[model samples]
Target: MNTTLFDRVSAVQADLLVTFVPSEGAFPESTAWVDGNADGQLSQLRESGVFKGGLAQTLLLPSITQDFAQPVLLVGIGKDAELSDMQARKVIAAVAAQIKSLPYASVALASRALVLKKRTQSEVTALIAQWLNEGFYNFLGFKQDDAEKATKVTDLLIEGDDEAALAIGTATANGSAFARQLGNLPGNVCTPNYLASKAQHFGEEYGIDVELLDETKMDELGMHCLLSVGRGSDQPSYLIVMHYRGGEEGEAPHVLLGKGITFDTGGISLKPGPKMDEMKYDMCGAASVFGTMKAICELKPKLNFTAVVAAAENMPSARATKPGDIVKTMSGKTVEVLNTDAEGRLVLCDALTYIERFKPKSVVDVATLTGACVVALGSVNSGMYANDDAVAESLKAASQISADKIWQMPLNEEYQQQLDSNFADIGNIGGPEAGSVTAACFLSRFTASYPWAHLDIAGVAWSGGAAKGATGRPVALLTRYLLDKAS
Candidate 1:
């Protein structure tokens, strides 16, 4: 959707004009242009209890005069002094939801009177645009009949002081939507090859350099640990590397490693039949990487970054890597595969070792590495484990700024003992206790060369029930960190 800014409601030529109406019918200064009978109509409605103007309450008043060609939407925003960014976003989201259901193709958000506590006008405007895009999102690509699909809101006018905020927010939201689409697709359709193609397209369109390593190249490069994870699947695995050089020459880039198990069937270690379909979302980490890439490409910040995705499919077959199988990673570290279900770490470890070639200033690997992460943090926050304190703190600050919650989990020596192997140098699966931490510990062995952080996004990667789709999390958080670094 195209988002533009207008100074006043009179200047908005859209089919609908949105105005925030506070409690007790306190008219916002932004909507003061609706004088005479139109203004009186709103006051009379509030007085007669036709509209209470309570928080989240909305009223649609038809325009009687030709001065404004659209209807006025009265959105309740509670109190002025108490208005917060969260509340403002919620209000805008609610408005956007209503607008989506309406017949109008164009809508304007008159945000001048919004008293956003502790937030600048630009920040508020940006957030509103972001939420509006999210609210208006629809995944109808697979719908058989296009006639049943609702008419999309194509033009969004955000009446605010700063225009750049709307642009930034829109770009971020678009990236997120792209990630969501990738996550929501069935695994059959969105394979590792599909992700590789997407990466190549992104690199070509955005001026980034792309390199794809097939199973043959991976074998030649000694990526046996990563290659082992996809041994069961007919679909060949790929190591996709994307380089975006926006900084000075020879600058060490920040590296992001994603565990891309396109369809995780647990191989020899089979998962329960129930909810197996949701395993298609196993590639959400890679999807988020793609999302962040889209965002940074749009922002074009002066920072070098590289994203690597170890794309594979975990399936059960005769060729599948069985329990007790041993594999050497690119780092030459041996690992005993006690369970095939614990494959994300296998791919990520090799990728982590592979990333050392880049000599990255810092590295953060994103993955849905364990169910224990879901048990520990639930769906509220991604579990974070870092080998370095500064990397952890940097990501935490970015999470705060992006409003993507993350809790730092312990990666102490105590957890490392659980990963000890009897036959090999290390075990793939730690014996159930502190499972999330041990998984991080497993990957930490390969990332010893650089400042590294692990984001276990198992819980917050996607929703379960009716709203089952990717959240495109941590992308916002990751993007914010790079933005801060670029600045």
Candidate 2:
């Protein structure tokens, strides 16, 4: 919405700077490759040298520098062959992130040509634009009025061949903005009803299809597990199902599920008070799916996919479901609620059960489901667990290419044992030992009929520092994987 940013990126020329494109496996030069200015000697920068870590093996820039009219920035590529399309997007994002911080009036980039058959410059640009915006994102929603406001990034430049770069630039800006919208909304505003409304608008705008099930509809269909979480709150729950049918008519749609806990009080087993406000973002897993569904419409992959979000708010009240309560999931399995805070698994159980009706070939669910994941992996990577080895490997391949980190965690029979209950088929909270792994195990019960995987995004969904909104869009990795797989 800031017009200054729009003017800056649009008015600037892409021919101002130089980019170093190194061969595969090249390290940055110890010093800046300063070109001698009009003085016919090394530029003043060399005499007064600067260290921006531009040429670092951050993979945002190519190894060599393209000498243009202004500054030269050296970007590193760990390997050349591995410099595929997804990596290209990652480099563009990193480059755009760095560019916003520099004092340059404009900059040019000579990164590698991203080679994908149907992927156009427009899509590439959209991706870079999205990444650039996200790279400099600041989450000031929770800041006190007396706190100093953080700086906003204004100047930005995208460089490449004129036609492709310009096209990519515009799309990136739009896609990033789309992503930001999902990440920025306060949890109350992005509730199940709110998300359903957004989905309808996104569907009409992009020519996709959205089917949202209201509380009454969910009750009619007997989605008790999902309904159970929202029973505590005055706000009703919803299952938002969106269809993106871009593949061949008969191709099975790859299904995606998101945990849509808009606000989590941990129910009777409340989350500790330290950073409880972040409960608003507990729905980020669902937000990512919703955002990715929107972006996929713009990207238009050659695959049919259904994204389903079980969105709701979890609050503790006299009517709230308490620990020791047992409820039957849509899958017809009963789960004993061991801890009220373990409600994400309850919501996801029903969503996973509903996917059986679709009978898709693969399923992946994302949720900010567990704090144990944060303790184990820290905030750097989302913990990935799977029922199928091949599916997990494919996702890992996608994660590496995207650089939005994910690491494999055990989801074995042993973990299932941890969720055992004497009075029910399964228990919501796994005993505290491998809490995250146990939560995955609990969800796995409903997903047992499908070759499914789970992403516990608890750690990756947000950053503790000043960045505004959700940390970054991790769904882009999954979207990229599905796109690559379909192509």
Off by over 4 Å in 1: 35-37, 64-69, 84-86, 146-151
TM-score for candidate 1: 0.95
Q: Write the per-residue lDDT of candidate 1 for residues 1-487, one digit (tens) a residue.
A: 7788887666668888888777754577765566343646666667777877777788787764665546888888775555865787678778877887788888888877676676677767777777778777777677787445554677888887687777777878888888888888999999999999999899779989999999999999999999999999999999999999999989999988888999999999999999999999899999989988998899888999999999999999999999999999888889999999999999999899889889999998999889999999999899999988999999998886666789999988888888888899999988978899899999889888999999999999899888888887777788878887888
**Once all C-alphas are superposed, what RMSD does model 2 give against the true structure?**
6.7
Measured on C-alpha atoms, candidate 1 has an lDDT of 0.86
* Worst 10-residue lDDT window, candidate 2: 1-10
The residue-by-residue lDDT of candidate 2 on 1-487, one tens digit each, is: 2211222222345423434333332322211222222231222322333322232233222212334244445444333533455566566656655655555444544332333334554455545545554554444556585134443334444433444334333433444445455656776676778888888998889888899899888887778878888888988889999989999887788998988888888878878897787788888888788767765776676899999999988888888888899888777788888888888888888888888988787999999988899999988788999989988998898776455688999877866777779999987876769888888888887877888989999888876656535764576666666766677
Of the candidates shown, which would achieve the greatest TM-score relative to the real structure? 1
Candidate 2 global lDDT: 0.68
